[model samples]
Target: MAAGAGQAPVVTNGIHTAGQPVELSIGLPHNLGTRIHLHLTILATSIIVFLSSATLDGAQAGAAMSSFIYAIPDRYNPSQPLTTSLYTQPSSQDFSARLAKVLVRRTGKLCYVGGSMNLANAVGGGTVDEEMEAFRAIVAVVAAEVTKARNAEE
Candidate 1:
């Protein structure tokens, strides 16, 4: 479906295994200063996400992984999740943590596996506005996937 007004357009690629929707991938608008791509692996217990920056030609590569993060729902209050990270580099971004926390809360999943590479730019890092756009795009696509997974369960 086309994005509504004031929404970032997302492109999704689904990869099924054994006729099951095991994996999903998507890319943000190519015109953005820092193109971001998201790949999701849906499991019975958790969902794993690989967040990356795209190449000039829109390939899903080129960014160096800066950190790995995970989040689990709080038993007492799932809305307040517990999140932590293992940084491979000093300049890791917190977008991964944000993504995990949001997903765990929204889906009420037991756990979420997520990590992000530095949004690479041939010139430099993306501007704040560009990065925010990327974040919004990721959230939008993830929410849609969560809905699809729930429907499949029904």
Candidate 2:
């Protein structure tokens, strides 16, 4: 279901064996900069986020998939999750790695993060600063939603 007015939309899309919804699809409000779209799929056992940079008009994808990062929380040190690459490692590798790490630390769930992003220029994409801003915003939203869902379960 969706949150109240002025809140991000968190949609439940699947059910668990216990007859409770287990999957959530979250879409951050468009006002966030960078024209980026973050789709956080909260499965029963893990969290997968598909992120993409869109053109200014939001009609086309602005980047290509170059990296995939996964993280599982380190029980002894939540700040530093065990993160690793699962695919091509782009020069901007730290972006996804850090995102996944933070999400795992916050939600204590295995997180798989894959996305396409590029530096902003005449063609498309967003500036490094803009991208960073978008990522931070995305992490906050994902962590909050996942935590909220887990709390409900408890």
Candidate 3:
């Protein structure tokens, strides 16, 4: 769907499960690929916070906290979905801390920084500063949600 003039991008509430992973779908504004970059950065940061604060076993925590990031297709086109999956390390990976670190680094590269320039370009465009601010806002929201989820579990 076309966004109204001056309207902000659409960001869905994140879905968190007890034993399953979480997923977030963000709708990009036209010509705002930078927003996607910010979203990824926010997601990666939030995942790290979730991993650190959660009280579950390392492996279980990693598995439970894994996140999938999805962007709505450009112009609301359903034919081209943009998605990235962040998985935790298997049980053998030193209590899964190593896996968490690996995921943080990899996700930072793929989503936060410039790992997938082409992908980012295809999604939307905006200024780096704007993206950074957007990322910060999103991180706060995601962090709060993660905390709420953890409390619910306890």
Candidate 4:
């Protein structure tokens, strides 16, 4: 609700601060398809990509954001597959990462973004278990994408 309006101070644990807009991005040394593949069965595969940290709340969530994804193959094998990376979103919203789900649906692949989450809200009622679950859910989705790609390949 603060967009185009005054930047509100996000407060947590008696700490108050305001953040500015920043670009978020992530990189990968493998293609989105292959990453999805390795993640599917948790296969031992190697992919190198620089990932960015961004935030986005999905439609299911409430916040949303825009981001970029990229990939570069190992300067060694150009015939194998393209390296891939997905940048979530560039916003100070807590749900920007989730909004990335929408982007995944459209592109049907895993993306990466680099950004810091508002530790303020996270400091309260937020535990490592919760964050780990979020990561697990993301991995599951990536695995699903790999499965879909395999099905398509077949």
lDDT of 1 at 115: 48
Instruction: List model 2 lDDT by residue over 44-85, tens digit each.
Output: 668888766544455554466758988898888768899889
Per-model lDDT: 0.62, 0.65, 0.34, 0.30
lDDT of 3 by residue, 25-122 (tens): 33333334333222222332234223221111222122233332322223364334333334423322232333233333333322211111112222
Backbone clashes, each candidate: 0, 1, 5, 33
Could you arrange the candidates by TM-score from highest to lowest?
1, 2, 3, 4
Model 3 misplaced regions, further than 4 Å: 1-15, 27-125
Candidate 2 segments exceeding 4 Å error: 1-33, 58-62, 119-125
Worst 10 residues of 1 by lDDT: 16-25
- TM-scores, all candidates, are 0.74, 0.69, 0.32, 0.29
Q: Of the candidates numbered 3 and 4, which has the greater TM-score value?
A: 3
Worst 10 residues of 2 by lDDT: 16-25
lDDT of 2 at 128: 61
Over 21-75, each residue of candidate 4 has an lDDT whose tens digit, in order, gives 1111211111111111111121122111122222222112322333434333333
Give residue 61's error in model 3 in angstroms.
33
Candidate 1: list runs displaced more than 4 Å: 6-8, 15-30, 57-62, 86-88, 111-116, 120-124
lDDT (10s digit) by residue, model 1, range 49-132: 776665465544544556677789899976699987755444653666777788888777744444454555523456666666
**TM-score of model number 4:** 0.29
For candidate 2, give the lDDT of residue 53.
56
